[model samples]
Target: MARRERPARVPPRWVVTGAWRVHRAIYRVSGGRVGLWRPKPGRWGTLRLTTTGRRSGQPRSVLLGYYEDGRNLVTMAMNGWGEGEPAWWLNLLANPEAEVEVRGGTRRVRGRAAEGEERERLWARWREIDTQLDELAALRSTRTAVVVLEPL
Candidate 1:
């Protein structure tokens, strides 16, 4: 009997990295004006997050979709729905201090991983906006990390 050939799977890491590269390029080439707007209707706004590289100790910026929760800004560390955590989240784990730009206003914030009930509450808000939250998360092996940035 002939063996069936399995379809090739593109590594999620490469996909996520490539996406960030393109996104950063766009943000940069646009002179900080474009790519600063919120996402589509029913979705959250976007923010520019700058985190210190854990190993290199350099600044790294990435645009992330975010929602305002009271005095905190909440974002997911899914790395574009990849199987691994985003680098920014890792940086936050190493050092929770970071800077974020929302609506052209920059602020220092302390990042924290929401746990237990807090996480569920924030995740539920995301689900309200993104109906595919669970479906997208199912693609990854680890549970998604919900990060809350508290202004300092």
Candidate 2:
């Protein structure tokens, strides 16, 4: 069988981190008018996820890329394709319940890591949107968690 080639390396960590910071800053400066977007055909959308901080017990919000699956929203804890787990994922693990702001409005959600065949299925779905998904995931030492946000 022919082996699939890996995608090019991602941008420097600082670049990736800085981009996210800028995105969040725009969301903040706009007073929630211009950040979140809806998923269009063959592309993922952006949403603002508000997860309670695991240690601080404070509301922590971050913008994430997600796509709708049935009535649920699906995302990956890729952490900018960095090595360690993202804080938002850890916070979700600590407290599964959270809130999300999408293009439509706010919704209360329960988060969980997809596993087994469910995970494989969702991963495949993501791959369709992101052709470099596997290559980016391979940069990390551990498997990225495919997070499913089910409506409460």
Candidate 3:
């Protein structure tokens, strides 16, 4: 039997952006007590990432979903499964150095786009986490970047 593919299920752009804003607001209101989590055996985790703004030279923070690959953390530079790259990702591209706050503690790290075999392996891992990863990725015109955050 031939296999069939399902269309990607993504929310409206405004709804997606609004959700991110609300999550950040909750994190701020709770004084960092909530909104962050650690990756589990079969699930991804949320982390608060702080990067230096490329043009402003100031700190900028965003929440990202990641999984552990040895001591390194891996995430995708997807903008709510939207068209353009996210601002946080652009900032990281300008200055690879950044900080991340996880459930147990914080870490200073350097970010880079995964490539070649590294990207394939990491992206496969993400596919395990999100079965629709490829479908969602197809929504964007440009290729989504698999980001690796290595400890500094």
Model 2 lDDT per residue over 5-108, tens place: 76558999999999999999999999988878999888999999999999999999999999999999999999999999999999999999999999879999
Residue-wise lDDT of candidate 3 within 8-99, one digit each (tens)?
A: 88999899989989999998999999998888876899999999999999999999999999999999999998888899999999999999
The TM-score, computed over Cα atoms with residue i paired to residue i, of candidate 2 is 0.94
TM-score for all models, in order of appearance: 0.84, 0.94, 0.94
User: Which has the higher lDDT value, candidate number 1 or candidate number 3?
Assistant: 3
Q: Which residue pairs show backbone clashes in model 1? A: none
* Tens-digit per-residue lDDT, 70-149, candidate 1: 88999999877766788899999998999998876899999998999999999999999976688778878999999999
Error of 3 at 136 (Å): 0.5
Q: Would you list the rank order by lDDT, best first? A: 2, 3, 1
RMSD of candidate 3 to the true fold?
Answer: 2.3
TM-score comparison, 1 vs 2, better candidate: 2
How many clashes in candidate 2?
0
| Model 2 residue pairs with clashes | none
What RMSD does each model have against the real structure?
6.2, 2.9, 2.3
Give the poorly placed runs of model 3, Cα more than 4 Å off.
1-6
